[model samples]
Target: MSTDRKPDIALHFAPRTRSFVALWLLEELGVPYTLESFDLRGGRPTTPEFRALNPLGKVPLVVDHGRPISETGAIALYLGDLYGAPEAVPAADDPDRPAYLRWMFFVGNVMEPSFCQKMFGWEVAPSTAGWGSYARMFEVLTSAVDGDGWLLGERFTLADVILGNYVRFGLQFGMLDADPRLERYAARVTARPSFARAMAIEERESARFPPAAA
Candidate 1:
């Protein structure tokens, strides 16, 4: 039994969703925290107890100092700042800030929405759709990963933390095919000890919750 202080940051997780992103971020930060796994399909997150934390009933929510924060992007950015790894996340004044911020937002704003749309059999008109289309989004993503091991070149930054998870999710869900670049990148990110540990936790928790009805 470990006796670390009740972490000021607690993550509400559900396996195989955006929770993995937060899990990876927490692992990367090497922070001491608690993970409260919710079975979303079982309404574990919607119960009166959890509803007080998030009325929307979403997983991947975080409580920091008793204040609730929802959405994966927000949680990732917050963790990056709190952990303060300049290598993992560049400072605002850093010359790489623009590219770094662009890719970070791209995962949430572009990739995720586009992924959901395509996964659900919805089609968006290119003229009005913010992501243009799923095809275009993949093209953009592949192009970004074309050059190097990391998104912003040799240094692995928070943008990698964001996009790396997306790539892994896309591959696991079959939303993405094996692009050599993405395949290589995914392997590199998951090969990290922290990511491997997070994956182990996710797998164990997933077994605890059976799948929803067909």
Candidate 2:
């Protein structure tokens, strides 16, 4: 059932990006892999070799068995399907499957654009915008994680890994300011052992590539 038949699993990654989600996922998978870590600002991903893998030259490019996957949501789903246990990825019969897929896409489709709109002061009607406005996105997210420990209740699946980083970044960048429930939820997700492992790697890579000057 695994896509990558070969043993080679390398993450084409850079720190301080969505690569954090991919890092968290690899740790959760508990699989042996290599990190092709680099600095985005240093033009590592833009090289001809790396650009062949992902034309956009983006980080979080996961190469499994020499096959490349670029998007963060897609990477989460890929690793979850291939290596994740039942707890990480519910079976087809599981009722949480639908919600799991929904929230995963919600992070990229809804949260990404909505956050951009809010940050850049973009003006668009709720009915016209696909995300219905950043305010609505927050409302739906807050409602989902308000009382529940995870998105699918007790089960902490790949959806958490997909959405948790965005929620954490939102708080850190003041995008989701003054939201107590979301703050607590982000804390809980980052407190996981897998997250700790990812953070350790992140720290090492970040030190390797200090951020570019503004």
Candidate 3:
């Protein structure tokens, strides 16, 4: 079931942000969509109109035929299934679908909070927190991706998009410096041509919205 009637997809985006992951996924899909790029410093996300669609006031919000879908994972799953089905998204009965969904959720459910925990020096019991401890999160991720293929093996699905971006950002933020498995995994993820194209766009946009002078 498709959400957008006209396929007039719009990505509310920002340069050098988590929006990059969304942008990357879009490029991988090779779909024609409009980019509503803006500088967050200008408060585009805070406006009432934007908030009406995305109360979280976050970038990487995708609007499909005027219907807004926020959150990277949700957006990724939605767009992938809607547009890239049977390729980026497995069929409902596909064996890979199970693994795909699990890895898709892992980034948000485990990785994100765990990274924040480590970054902010928050101490939470592994059993208490949703993501467990950062160390435990890394251990599990290492076990998952410490291999010669993508998360779903031969076929690269949207799980790669969701989790791969996590790995890339993890390395960028020095969060995954302790492990080489994720490093190798990210190497393959970045090696994709879409990653290159997305980085190119990211460069072009970042230049337009250059960082403010320190």
Candidate 4:
């Protein structure tokens, strides 16, 4: 067995949140790390202890080398770049870098908010909204994949790591209907040994802190 201790990647995870993305990235990197699960029900993340890590009181926060990194895209990109896993993340010099960054941020900034808006019946004007509308966002997402196994052609980069979580969540919550392409892609990605292990961890965490309150 490897005697080296896992890198100090402190993940403050909560059930049914974007923490899954960080967990999946850790698994994909095949690195050992510590997981500090926080319950959102009691406002645990907002407590002084957790607030010191992230004032926003959000899950999916990571403290690497004592540097707190919140936001899923930031954490994924940081890990992928630091670990030199170009296959999991494109290099900055790659021609696809622009596209990769664009989509990665889009998932967090655009798609996620749109999903929440649609799910919660929030009021908004399509003209003023960056996401335009839920249908529009979904259409764009579908077109981006277009039956591809991954977001960037044959390469399964960090883009997949970002979008894969949403695809699964959307399908599970009935926010997204069955698209053969998305179905195939999600299946293919989740079937990876790394993803399987991540899902196991997430499942256990979910059991420990159910998402009913969140």
- Name the best candidate (by TM-score): 3
lDDT of each: 0.82, 0.87, 0.87, 0.80
- lDDT score of model 4? 0.80
TM-score of each: 0.89, 0.94, 0.95, 0.89
Residue 97 lDDT in model 2? 85
lDDT of 1 by residue, 21-45 (tens): 8888888878888998867787787
Question: Candidate 4: worst 10 consecutive residues by lDDT?
Answer: 1-10
User: What CA RMSD would you report for each candidate?
Assistant: 4.0, 1.8, 1.7, 3.8
Judge candidate 3 against the unseen true structure and give its global Cα lDDT, from 0 to 1: 0.87
Superposed Cα RMSD, model 2 = 1.8
lDDT per residue (tens digit) for residues 97-153 in model 3: 888888888988999998888788998888999888998888888888888888877
Off by over 4 Å in 4: 1-6, 210-214
Q: Write the residue-wise lDDT of candidate 2 on 15-107 in tens digits.
A: 888888899889988888999888787787769998999999888899988799899999888778787877879766788888999999999
| Candidate 4 lDDT by residue in tens digits, 15-116 | 678788899888888776899986678778868988888788888898888989888888877777776366667787888888888888888888888888
Point out where model 2 deviates above 4 Å. 1-7
Per-residue lDDT, model 3, residue 210, is 96
